[model samples]
Target chain A: MSSSSSSSSSTELSIPLHVKYIQSLGENKDDLIYHMTSHLRLNAIYWGLTALCVMNRQDALDREEMIAFVMSCWDEEAGGFGAHSGHDAHIHATLSAIQILILQDASDKIDVPRVVNCEPSKHIFHSRRTLPEMLTEGLPLLVILSLQQPSGVFAGDAFGEIDTRFSYIAVQSLSLLGQLDKLNVDKTVSYVLKCRNFDGGFGAVVGAESHAAMVFVCVALLAILDKLDEIDQETLAWWLAERQLPNGGLNGRPQKLEDVCYSFWVLSAMSILGKLTWIDADKLIQFILSAQDPENGGIADRPGDQPDVFHTLFGVAGLSLLGYPGLETIDPAYCLPESVTKRLGLRKNWKALPKRT
Target chain B: MPRVTSNNSDDEAQLYCEKSEWQDITPIPQYDGINPIAPIFYTPEYKDATEYFRAIVKADEVSERVLQLTYDIISMNPAHYSAWQYRYRTLVALKHPLDVELELMDAFAIKFLKTYQVWHHRRLLLTALRSSAPSPLSIASKELAFIIRALSTDTKNYHTWSYRQWLLAFFDDEELWEGELPYVERLLETDVRNNSAWHHRYFVVWGRVRAEGEIDVGDVLKREIAYTKDQIALAPNNPSAWNYLRGILEHTKTPFNSLRTFVELYSTQTAPGEEDIVDLDNPKPGPGAQLPCAPALEFLADIHEEMGGEQTKKAIEIWKSLGNEYDTMRKKYWEFRVKEALSV
Candidate 1:
């Protein structure tokens, strides 16, 4: 193993290193960190796979194996994917699972009909449903719709914890499943509009401070629902553009530290708003590249930090949005490969940076 | 099902068993070029924690042992959401007192004030108690006090603010609604620039119109306008106050030009014919220590943009100065505004 290097001169993304880094994550089953992060295992796989896809190395990870693992995370009772096999179903993991399947072109493997209608009564006597069948219930869309609170914001689950993030996840998940007609679009859009602060950015919930991540979710949700005009675009774009610091890294909120993840959050919003030029792309690309673990295969929150799959995916995804050379273009609205989103006819009007030759 | 061993010393056995079972899976290629594992992943303590968590999950046991295991995990890493989930499940299964769970969460809340799971767990407990509690309003009031304490420690804590908003939704009490503005006033008195406090203020004032169904919005707007003006006078550069001021004005449909007193107090001017020039360097500010702060200029520009002809020309001038002088970081944005104003 090589030593961690802190050189900023290496502006190139170490795609091969990152590919290996992601590959190495699943190699050590005995590692305590692996078990510790089991809850995020499915999300991690999506991050890793998406990062690989952005790097033009989508096949680096074994597809069959990856699909098997994602299917394993089915929470049978809730009709949604859980973070891990034993974890309860949540909207987040379910979205990640669906995205992963779409990326792998294995979406057809999902038994939507069985999963959607699989009732507890049906399962009680049969005991014959496969693990995937038990978990991949068509109920996810219904479950997601059910989580919509009276205020129009969605709960992450039956726990009734409402957040704009959940709204975005629900919107995207339903749209992907062609179930947008089932959603209360007017109510969802109204709640999102209420979360808008005077700064033109959105918060996780109403009355919360505006954050770049929350802005992305709200904006993306609006775009999906075709209600982008409901917000003050110019003011929001100004707030988003201001997220960039001198170092070219973006922060979630005012007075927060710059992080690599905001590259996706901030840039995606800018992309959707047709304000991609507002950002200093070259400097941001350099910042994202600098956060790469030159020795490891993943990117970190910042330089000198340990690399993780979450930041790695976002960094690469941001780079893709920035029109980095040889990388796949990402749909800023969905955080998926442009090709995949387009193929599914779920693409919106957002623009990515023109890919450099 | 695996026989769950409670011995902490058997961590290695737990790891070995899990590893052996997965041995048949094809190992991923390790790029020889990659770096060694970070030191953070190699600690014995981390290994033990993970092993204990694995054993608990494998056992699928919702016992006191699992509760302790989850608590141990959570103490070290409050952001570990799965551990919190397990703990919540265990608490519910064991029928642990909601108050006890709340008390246990207090230490975690203080230690990891920003952690989402801790705040979420607190919300779950409070929500669970809402239906059965003899006095739900009192419980909500108490939670509000707890949240206020949390906010006092880190005035801008997002999770705390969100939780506070969540808790407030349960109460329809006029007294509770009445208390909110003063509570915000107290917070803003401590820190005039606390944006969260300002946001809470907005929620209280505007939210009342929706919640109560009969509020004298005109009166509230007048009071809020005065409050924001006072806040701005205290700190002209405070964006929170400016935002609050703008929100109140917009909600009330009070035209920017209609704020005659405010405009006279804060308006800045550029030299004749110089307004058209896009000065990239050494832009001039309006004369004086008090007038033409960025927000004031921007607000005036908005009003002028809404009005046409002569006012549009004046708005362009203000935009030019704002781009170059007061809000230089957003010079390009201000320039865009100028262009937009000129086009109008």
Candidate 2:
């Protein structure tokens, strides 16, 4: 990573302050924003935990308390997890629950089936239906697989709102649970291919405009499925590289404002494609650092914006992929700490820049 | 979804927990006090509403009262998917007029444009309306009009654009696709740099490549290439137009050199003079256009590289200039491109 930029003078990650900020997030019980954000509660926890992990302060947030929160969000009736307690189960929240469990070395908390025992149902299924033999074990795996439509795209919930994002979540969750063999890889990959735009970037759904966040999900899911050969790598890389603006921040789509979150969305996809070297690391590091709230910690979408956990996690994850100093390496394909993915033996072919000293 | 604060005194004064009709239901707290983990301190108002919501779900009550309760929950937190799902089920069970429900959603959709549940609820209503309504086409048209109004507020909202795309494809009517191109054109005209509008253009034109009674593919290609050039002239640095230009060429398997002259028009840093003669075949950048546009330079380089032999040197120079000067943010990408080409 290049260090020859004027950004080196006034910008530092302020990891200590950021760690404090994350630790304090759950302490305020009376904040109205807290109640309003119950729908994103589980996902927010994952982001905070992952950001803390990336900064190499995994223990800053009590592991026992964090794991308990994740388990509390489990929706036993739906065979999956929800965003918060008393909320219905959703695929997005289920993935976050699994991610947090793995990050905290609590993967064993989720009991898995010894073998795939989903018997084909006699009744006609809209898609290929697999009746779960044992619901107690591998319930999330069942919930996820049940959501895939005949078109191969997974729905966020029973409401049937399909997107490439859910496809990625399903793939990632199944892979983490060691149940990827149950997924129809070909069908899932074909759906992702359908979402690809002329610019070589992926979108939320077929016929929608390409966005960097969707690109990351599609690319990472493809990598997990070992179907990297399917994409137009060079074309997509060029599109991803072009997302970097003159200010050194990346945007999710063309002509959009530069946001810190796209730093991870664009960079993670590029890293999975082995095109991480294409970005100007020095300038991007400067941009990500500039978004940091030096006094209170946490990174924002842009400089001077109120910092939030979503952008904060993305910012730290982007910095980790950029080889920022004294940070844990994040797995580009999974968004988990490299150590976690490596230990799980689920790491895919991805390349992050060399860690800067 | 961020909290949508209401200034109405009525909204502030109302509390379901205090009402006599809601007295029979016991509120269910999100977490029991036994070692609650990262518990959200919900407001007394939200707490009351959600507690009653839990009671209704447990009781399996799909009634008019449940509708009002779900609405109160949703108004406070638009992303409560459970509330949305329950509300839809209630609407269906009560045999309520979905059009009236849709009318209620119109303002809510605009108020919470980015919320996924809001759009999804609209999708469910439209899907239901289509199957039962006498004229599905009328429903489709009105929904399209509503989407246009939603797009006016936030032109690039992902949910709005994708929902619009879903609506067209769902209807699969010739009339729906017919008006799509002109609608996209107006959006592009308003903001030439709108990628969503440009993507919709691709969806409309190329999506009809071999449809029955459509225009010739060859004619469509020529018209699109010219249309893209005109857009590029308006804003030289706009990557969306350039990407569309490349998309058209690559999708049709047309050679990059086909537009070499047009590509060269914006390759140089010089702006056109007021008296400069206009060329219909090659559009010149407007006075406001930022010259030495990186995409145009890259296109020129690709054209030269396609020619092979001595022309490859010209491609190398352009690539070097892009890295060293024009687009320094992606300097490393240009360097890598040159290295990859040389190695091959």
Candidate 3:
């Protein structure tokens, strides 16, 4: 499915029947796009796996070509990432590419600064604008803050449900853009702090089950800002470690089966804390390796499973962090290169990690 | 399959990602080290790992040969405790009650005990116990004691923690308050940072208090809120602390007794800045984005209604504190109300 089909009929012909069937199932493509793209936890997995697709072809397709191909998953108009070609943009995919680009230092390859600083997608010419514009018009923050309605929140220019996960990412993206210096962290953290759950894991809101992936966003937001001390370390560690399954994987919740992407959620958290050794690294790596489809050079959630790029990335990263031979050792603390993390000049514990006021 | 991303508008803008990102997956550089990974995957040594997986899937036959093979796999990799644990999950999921019962107790009582998985299995076992019609409390109590004995099995065992809550849910208030509350108290004493213990403590005494008509409502609210604050102090990013605090806050209105506390929480904490970055508004103006802010306004109105007139007054005060003076707030609020009413 070369995106350069140069013919509209080509792309329409390639729209797999299975995908059309999936869309026909109740949810509009918009819902599917939102669900997949919003799962920011699996960002690296998406790109890493997508990279395998293009890179596996060898020098025939260089890394630059491969990345451009993968970037197509990012919905520029809506500022989200899709799972694959033709999917809608979402937060999950957005985080995936962001992680991939950051980890790869591919920011230069892409207009990283532009995308990071891309303001709330408001004021687009809707009638003349395309579907992406129609979708980008949904950014809940710019809607509310824009005061598009009568009330402060309701009147904002964009419209988004003020869930904790988005709240964290919304702030994080701002922080990532170095817009935090001009922004009010006090007011932002104050509002976010309310979304904190008593389980010691943050959620979409208070009283919700403490999800692992969301916890990563909450913890990472604090960690990146040098505010790790605000988290209940023992509680969070316990919650995170508790997510590891008997199958050598981590799950979002207890009683749930382990999945491939949780490797990033649980592992990244452990890496940040210098606590990767607490879990059985060999067992986790073995589980991850078993999920890989050696034939396709991509990984899956379980053995003999359909291969995908997202799982492949996490599975490999999981292996790398265990000091696996020949694999580049990931700085588990930030789940990035020791060199790159150093380049960021991250503090001993990321930063001051001040107790949340 | 979905080709929604295709378009010619940003053709030159298709940015490329870098290559080093893939290094974690195909780490060719680090393989030259002592503990290599790729080769091991292709090696016969990995067969030992699969052998155990087969044994668990085959454990039901009860043949001496099958039992021995399963036991061998269990012994071969104590580090792969998850495999041992999953073998137990499959067995529980299969609901072979009698088969797992004695074996499970022995597994829990093993010389070198690890209950992270065993406890999870025990929870499954307890949940499954009812269909078998034996009230599973005896086994649950036994397992709870084992969890206490092997607290070091996994200190962060939410499996063990929640199971205790489940068991307490079945128990009466008198027993829960008099008997279990003390035990949870003992847990919190041992490890104040144990969030499960904190949650258990909240559910035990405070839950009973709620059931018994809010006895010591103020005290319980103060205590749990303090604990939530303490948890945030310990791990500011912990969502659960915020969760438990919200639960306690919702369950106990006494904490919101004064306007000061309400303003402190609302102005500072309540839902923060837009996290989702959703494009909720059409932004085309002119009937395009009509009443996009209705939900938020409705939410505030609902809160105002819940608090009666008191909250509305507090809102006025908060507005004033936020720099919108009293008279201006009063004037604008009424004016907005008039317009809103007239529009309706």
Candidate 4:
């Protein structure tokens, strides 16, 4: 491979090496860093697994064992999953668990009610069709729905701290579980529109500054909810395209240092808006490739920084969306394999760049 | 490496499982022996601490000992939401002094500034403090001070900024909202390109719709536009200030051409030739400032486009310059803008 040399300018992604890095992550049981990051274990697993899948190397990690670990993190009392075993249930960890299970074809492990599959009228609040009784009972549907605040935002957990991120998670989780029928779509969407700033970007919450990551959550949520018409797509797309820096990497916001992760966050939003061609794809591809640890085999936040699963996943996911060669397509809205979303009938109108030869 | 004698004297050396008083509590391991998948091999310290935590939670215990355990666990892992939530419950149940707890959390919050749970825990504490304290006003002031200190470390930490916004609105006190603009000004003075400061300025200025008799909305919009122009004068390249300028215009339903001359000053290609022009109404860029600045040029294009007919052609010309010369990085976007405008 061209990566044998120490130069950071290698133009090709070290897919084999990244696969090795991920495989090695599970072997370091004695590493204290592993234990310290237990709170993010499930998320880490999802990242690692999704990265491997995008690289067309899904078998890099053991599927059965991964599924078992996800199930083990389930908080039986809360009807949601925690980050790890013995950890309390959280909305985020629950989403990770659901994603992992669905990817592994083990979603039946999640005890969602059968009534969730019935689709209701679009954006119409039926007087009789309220929160489903089965969902209100101990189930993942209730666990997610209960977190929605009266103002249409969502708290991360029972702790009552709210963010637009939780709203996206809730939307995605409900959609994935086939329970969109129960969601108060107008109420949920009203709050997101409130977070829109003049720059045509969304924020983490109302009155917060627009950020690329928050843009992804809000835009993706709107896409999933089929509420994209509410956003000013052209203005937002222009703002997103402006995130690309001279170095080719994109920043989360204006005047911030470019990081590899925004390649996904910014690109995903643009992709959903059907404006993926607004930014320089070739330069961004080069930038994402440059952030790879050509030797040790993981992508970092930037060149010369330490590599981790989160950035590695985002790096690959970004490349996949940019039509990088020899990778599977990723759904810009779902952040899952495009195939997975299609199979689940949850794919939205988001577009990825055409796959390269 | 062996445990040092000096470290042994501190609470760090003690094991929760080894303590005599905790003998009644059985440590519940994370996984059963039947099929352990990807179990984390925790250090003796963390393993013992969490196992005890699991046991205490299972036993429904909320005491001082549980508080100490949760704190130790949290110190080791700040993202431990369960530990933070459990600790908060324990504090509330025990009727512990939350003010003292907030004082202790200051150091921890700084240490774990990036952790979501740390900020959320602070929010929970303040919410609790709001009801228990005799004067929520003092708590609000103290929190604002603490947030100012925190912002000194990271001027744009999303959590800290949002918390400050939430604090002000939650208190709904005039004094809290009154100091916010100056605070935002100080932050902007430190860094003109700080988007968070610009955003906060907008939040404070236009956050709540004023009653008709309270303040003149037109005057406020005028002042905001002027302030934004002044900041834009400091750094014409800053998108944040430019966006704020446009934002103020959009919110007031003001036409873009209203700032045509000011936008023209920054969007012009030719240099000012060291003429030292000082105009407060429409300040010119500094000597070293890059002329035909991209954001300014974009704004200028928008202004022209807003005029329609013959002026739309002028907008297309500026956008063409942006795509073909000034800002080729987003050449496609500018081209799209041109295409959209031509189609219209």
How well does each candidate superpose onto the true structure, as a TM-score?
A: 0.78, 0.92, 0.40, 0.92
How accurate locally is residue B260 in candidate 3, as Cα lDDT from 0 to 100? 27
DockQ for every prediction shown: 0.16, 0.50, 0.03, 0.46
- Candidate 4 local Cα displacement, residue A323, angstroms: 1.4
The better-scoring model by TM-score among 2 and 3 is 2
lDDT for each residue of candidate 4 in B233-310, tens digit (9 for 90 to 100): 888889899888888888889998899889888888765666656667987887788888988888888878877889
Q: Supply the global lDDT for candidate 1.
A: 0.76
Q: Identify the leading candidate in terms of lDDT.
A: 2
Q: Tens-digit lDDT track for model 3 on B59-169?
A: 333332233233444444332333444545445555555425544455544443543334444444555664563655555555556556655565555444544555555
The C-alpha stretches of model 3 lying farther than 4 A from their native spots are A1-46, A49-61, A66-159, A195-198, A331-338, A344-357, B1-344
The residue pairs found clashing in candidate 4 are none
Candidate 2, residue B20: how far the Cα is off, in Å: 3.6
The alpha-carbon lDDT assigned to residue A146 of candidate 2 equals: 94
lDDT of 2 by residue, B183-202 (tens): 98898889999998999898
In angstroms, the error of model 3 at A125 is 13
Off by over 4 Å in 1: A1-10, A28-33, A109-139, A295-297, B1-97, B128-131, B210-223, B258-293, B322-332
* CAPRI tier of model 4: acceptable
- Looking at model 1 chain A, report the run of 10 residues with the lowest lDDT sum: A111-120
Q: For model 1, report the TM-score of its A chain.
A: 0.91
* Per-candidate count of clashing residue pairs (backbone under 3 Å): 7, 0, 76, 0
What ranges in model 4 sit over 4 Å off? A1-9, A108-138, B1-10, B20-24, B32-35, B274-277
Among residues 3 or more apart in sequence or in different chains, the pairs in candidate 1 whose N, CA or C atoms overlap within 3 Å are A17-A297, A18-A297, A115-A136, A115-A137, A115-A138, A116-A137, A116-A138
